[model samples]
Target: MARIAQESPGAPHILIVGGGYVGMYTALRLQKKLRRELRRGEVRVTIVDPNSYMTYQPFLPEAAAGNISPRHVVVPLRRVLPKCTVRKARVTELNHDEGWAIVQPLAGPPERISYDYLVMAAGAVPRLLPIPGLAEHGISLKTVGEAIHLRNHVLEQLEIAESTDDAELRRKALTFVFVGGGFAGVEAVAELEDMTRDATKYMRKVTPQDLRFILVEAAGRILPEVGPDMGKWTAEQLRGRGIDVKMNTLLESAVDGRIELSDGSSFQAGTLVWNAGVKAAPVVRRGGLPVDEKGRVKGTEYLTIEGLVRAFTAGDNAAIPDLTQEGMYCPPNAQHAVRQAKLLGDNIVRSLRGKTLKPYVHSNVGAVAGLGLHKGVAQTYGFKVKGWPAWFMHRTYHGAKVPTFNRKLRVVADWTLALFLKRETVSLATIEQPRADFQLAALDDVRPKERAADQAREPAA
Candidate 1:
């Protein structure tokens, strides 16, 4: 048990976990709907998340490619939700029976927070498999940090290849392998490919032909969100650019910079990115909530947990039943997560007012994906679009969907600036460990000069 935080005596508290799309949007909606109660001190809205900002995940690929500035893709929670109390903490445990949750603060001890109502929207983590060496070598693109790291890493590889005279070393440095073919994997690879190709123009030794970009998919087709025809077209388009689109293939191993495929082919590559899939965030399962087999919190069509009236869930963490699809839960994607959040917010308000709740039902809106600059694929409103038009649609749709008008304008401004300026391709990998050199210098200063001289003068045994 944890010590309870101080709170207002007469106000009902609504505690929301996670700061992703669902958590941020739901809190935004709830604050707007419950404005009167909040002003009167009848209710208090509190949100707890490890990050102070909500990352718009759909733009991660573009962020990785330097197409959009990383800072513009995330919305600061404090700036957006001034009325709500924002805690930078992770919900470590949930005890709904006692109406309190355990939160681990960013830099301190765990504390207990009692709530009248709870909303779980912690989102998902990368679904990793037991493939050997994957834990050591595999990287993902789930967060802004990861996206920025990947951009730096990809550029670093190009630098290595450009300077290397050994053909094998050059080959290994230039080869990039991406696993999975979903929207994340496809878009990430495509955008990075575009950036890398453009970057090679500045390198004297490296050319587009020298780069090897391989995409491995276990499924027969890629981008299942779009129909099979579009998936096929997308693969063909990738191949047209000299990318190896290996369908129905499995990555047998990526051990020690050596990649082995099920097709009996192997290669040494410096970069290996894994975007296979996502599972519900561990906090959901570990918090003792009732969850489905896939570890998602079990919820009704109204987005409330089965046995708990005050507990609600949405987004990737919740197994929301799809009324339109028989024997299937809603797919854990941005499309469903954003829609469910809107309805979940409204339902929470209705529940507080003692009104009948409405079931969440939204027909599938088709999918759209960017295949680098001036190239994309989209299926919306029973129509299929490809090439530049699809690319424009992708930007337009996501630009509108990205939460907060300020962020939308910033994203638009980034795109506008790109028209006249060349894409920034310099690697800033040092940003990951920005203080290492300073720390080392400080440590060196602390050493005794006489002891250092004695150690240096001593001969090896």
Candidate 2:
């Protein structure tokens, strides 16, 4: 019930849940455009999210490869949204009828928050398959932490490969399996495989030829964000890079480093990275919002939740009506999310001011992916570009669109320094098992008593 001192008798308060792409950007624009409303103490904005930062997911592969620093990929929510109250918590329940929500605050117990307007931008989560051990063993490469973990795990595999004398164990440890063929999957394998290759130069026993990189897709092709032809070409290009592309294949089991696949093939790997796809965060449907076939909030072209007058939904959480194609919905990508955010903001303003809200419409501009340094594939506007141009396009496009100017410059600087600097192959894998070493040390301290008892039981000498 903590309210900032801007309460007029009947001022409108906006409660934005999920400070992700749509929430952050919409509030930012609202804060700027509604400055007078705030100065007059007539309107206010508040944002809530589980994290204090919004992750730029497209840069995760680059971050995993150490092309960009992990810290710079996150935009601090509180720092940018000075005009709004930023609540670091998750919304557990929504009471839209009463204009209130129960928020599980990051620091304290659950509490209530009331507002005249609501924005649902809670975003998405990693979609899992029914395959055994996929949930427990598979790591999703969708966050900054996950990217760092992937980098560390891949490097740890290399280290293990270098020390192991058993050829089978060595091969298994060095094998890296990625189950997905979209941008996240393709880029992740390309970047990490490149990193492994570059790292081999520093290893005494390991080489690029000894490492195995496998990209698995359950469907006929990859990168459905683009299309079949480009996706097919992308697979061929990946094969050219020495990566095994398994189409129409699915991983069946991965229990204790043993793996089984749909093609009756088996292998062992120390690392399993899953980037299959994304489903709208489960909270979206649980919030008592109108959901469609895929559990995404059904919304009109205006981006408002279909049945609610004061509530709106955007980003990956909303099943926004796709005006471009018949009986379709917008794909969950930053391209549409960022574009829809602008109109979401504008429409909110119009709603508050009793003006007409505009419709949301934007066609897919295209997709650009970074394979390795000076290597990528892009098909846009009925044109195909590969090699250096595709790589450059990938960099330039994401560099320009990565949210903040501060991030933009950092990404640019990373690429610029990359030209003259050798790739950093060092991995901080020990972090995953920090406590294991301590446990071993404690066990070593206690083993002397057991050894003495064993010697006593033996024949006197």
Candidate 3:
């Protein structure tokens, strides 16, 4: 294997994989705590990720609804981690026992890097099932790009419904199906539905009633993060908004946009969104590391991977013991991910200095979700809240947690400007294929020249 060149071969190097919440926060804390060591070349820190930026996933629903700019939802990793080496690459394999890792860059051969310590924060990917036609027809909302594409696609569907004369085509174009009823699924359907309803007012043929939004959940309730009562309340609110909330139902198939539900219902929808759940990233399982049945790296309360020396983990991919609840593990969410990362960073420093490591402990705060403009539900501090107050709380809580003062300012500014101006409903579909028009023109020019040459050679026609 090829070796990555290191500037300080003698100093202890810390390698952090994945630039998500856990990876970014841990490295940021390390940079500050080990500032003197980093400056003196006594230690080295490096981070690797496929993308140059770390996306704040909470604002994705709003970005999909055009409430916030896509650029503000992601923080540039290079700008934030100026003290550490940030490589835009993917870690293909890990041999923690040998203290070496194989990483594949964007456009090059794989290279192996040796590290004195390893921080596995590789996060998770969408958990998909074997439902027929799902791989081909369903859309995901994991990244900023996906969010942008979904927004444009929804508007395009409305345009199609407005222009089509056939009743079947119009009906298909007007229907949207979303599977899963968790926070991401509920918030996404609500926001996009709101945006679509607002856009219909400007259309000549398409009316708000023509749009059909469906939410499917196998469980009997939605938003289980909150209590069952709140979940039922949220579902009722969605139904009141003219959305079809189907509980205790499964999506059996979606062959060519014809959806078959386990509840004996069928429909044709132009759009299908899948937000069921997510699992550990594939790379985490590829490595010969100790993982539980759920494929998460086994970790102790100190944030150190069990059965491994100088190895640490945090985030959705790590199965750390939850102190608040016996016989249970930490739930995979942004709340725990952020807190574990800070403790992991401190523990790493403490280990290096031969100090006692601290355990990860944080009680459950609560759950909050926004269900369109001035509509939401929240449960925190043994109290329940809904309606506009819950919406305000959701905004306030997440607005403070999005990381970086710069990002916080931009997010707040987006909300501030939204109050004075109307929401922009125009879709820029051409952005997805900006070069299509140029390619078509070139093809047209070539066809004319070819036809003229052929006629001249044939001497007539």
lDDT of 3 by residue, 356-388 (tens): 999999998998999998999999987999999
For candidate 1, list the clashing residue pairs, or say none: none
RMSD per model, one decimal: 2.3, 3.6, 1.1
How would you order the candidates by lDDT, starting with the best? 3, 1, 2
Tell me the whole-model lDDT of each prediction, alpha carbons only.
Answer: 0.92, 0.87, 0.93
Q: Which ten residues in a row have the lowest lDDT in candidate 2?
A: 1-10
Itemize residue pairs with steric clashes in candidate 2: none
Return the candidate ranking by TM-score, descending.
3, 1, 2
TM-scores for all candidates: the values are 0.96, 0.92, 0.98
Q: Pick the candidate with the highest TM-score.
A: 3
lDDT of 2 by residue, 1-461 (tens): 43323334688989888888898899888988898887777898888888888898889998999888998789998888787888888888887888878878766567876789999999999888788877777898888999999888888889888988999989898889999998999999999988899999999999888988999999988987667777888889889878999999989998887778899989888789988888888778778888988888888999999979989889998898889888888888899998888889889999988999999888877888889878888888778788889999988888888877888888888888988999888889878789998999999988998999999999976
Model 1 ranges with Cα > 4 A deviation: 439-461
In order of listing, the candidates' clash counts read 0, 0, 0
Identify the superior model by TM-score, candidate 2 or candidate 3: 3
Clashing pairs in 3: none
**1-461 per-residue lDDT for model 1 (tens digits):** 47779989868899999989889989889889988888788989999998999999999999999999999999999999988899999898888888889999977679988999999999999999999878888899999999999999999999998888999999999999999999999999999999999999899999999999999999999999999999999999999998999988998888898999999989899999999999999899878889988889999999998788789999988998899997788888888888888888899899888999999898898999999999999999889999999999999999999988999999999999999999999999888899999999987887788688899999999
Please give the distance, in angstroms, between residue 292's alpha carbon in candidate 1 and its true position after superposition.
1.0
